[model samples]
Target: MPNNIKFVKESKSKFLTTKEYHGYGQILKISDDGIEKHIVVKPKDPVFGITIKFLETGHPQFSIPDVSIDETAIMLKNLEEAKTFCREFYERRDEFVQDAI
Candidate 1:
């Protein structure tokens, strides 16, 4: 199993007019019952926070404080859904990273 994965984000602050950025991340885990779990660390703003919210199906969703800059929000129904979302997010993130590099 993979040990750790780190995702980074870099951007220029409009107010500061300088490159300012940060990262959002989570910790992966396999439970004793052989269930995959994600222990989210620094969640994205306005979507995910420190607390973990689980549903009846054992799925999880988190919320960030005020980062979206819009009324729209992000959510996940299950681990698979979360994975799909992360895949898309990373795909876009990679594009941005490549452009930055």
Candidate 2:
């Protein structure tokens, strides 16, 4: 995770944003059920690699990999592409989410 990065909700939007650090990205909450699902992006390395994750909340951590969920990533090459895709993804969330999951 990037240091000092915090998520703040965008005005009239369902997603969150963090300032550019190594890379920039968005956080989209996709579920409100028992185990909330959140889609977030973060840098994979020294600022270039971008990784998107489909996160499940309210679940107890396991010692080993026991369970799994479907469709957990939105892979991108660099910060620029990640930034562009974040915009596009936010604009077409419904379409992208359907394909993503």
Candidate 3:
């Protein structure tokens, strides 16, 4: 991931821009659920070389500490929002890692 890269929403559309680090590429997916946004990212594990990790099926963290339905998730209603969220989510945190085996 390139540092401080910018993503812009088109005047009447949306788009995604990417940057390469070492040799890994970035990917983003955005979705809507009538009331919120969902941004999902699959990044290559730096410690394991360029092996991009993935989930076989389902929300990879379905077994995390249970919470009430009031829990909040970052909502990305479109492509541009998703791209921004991906950049922030990956870069802003160190211990907040999300992974599934």
Residue 78 of model 1 has an lDDT of 29
lDDT for position 3 in model 3: 45
TM-score: which is higher, 1 or 2?
Answer: 2
Off by over 4 Å in 3: 1-24, 42-101
Best by lDDT: 2
Ranking by TM-score: 2, 3, 1
Better of 1 and 2 by lDDT: 2
Better of 2 and 3 by TM-score: 2
Tell me the spans in candidate 1 whose CA falls farther than 4 Å from its real position: 1-25, 33-52, 55-58, 68-101
- On TM-score, the candidate that comes out on top is 2
For candidate 1, lDDT tens digit of each residue in 1-101?
22124334433433221112222333322112123222222334334433334421335454434445353343333233345444443445433333333
Write model 2 residue lDDT over 1-101, tens digit each, in one string: 22322323332224432222222443334432223334545444433345554323322121111222331232332435555545555555554345333
* Clash count, one per candidate: 6, 0, 2
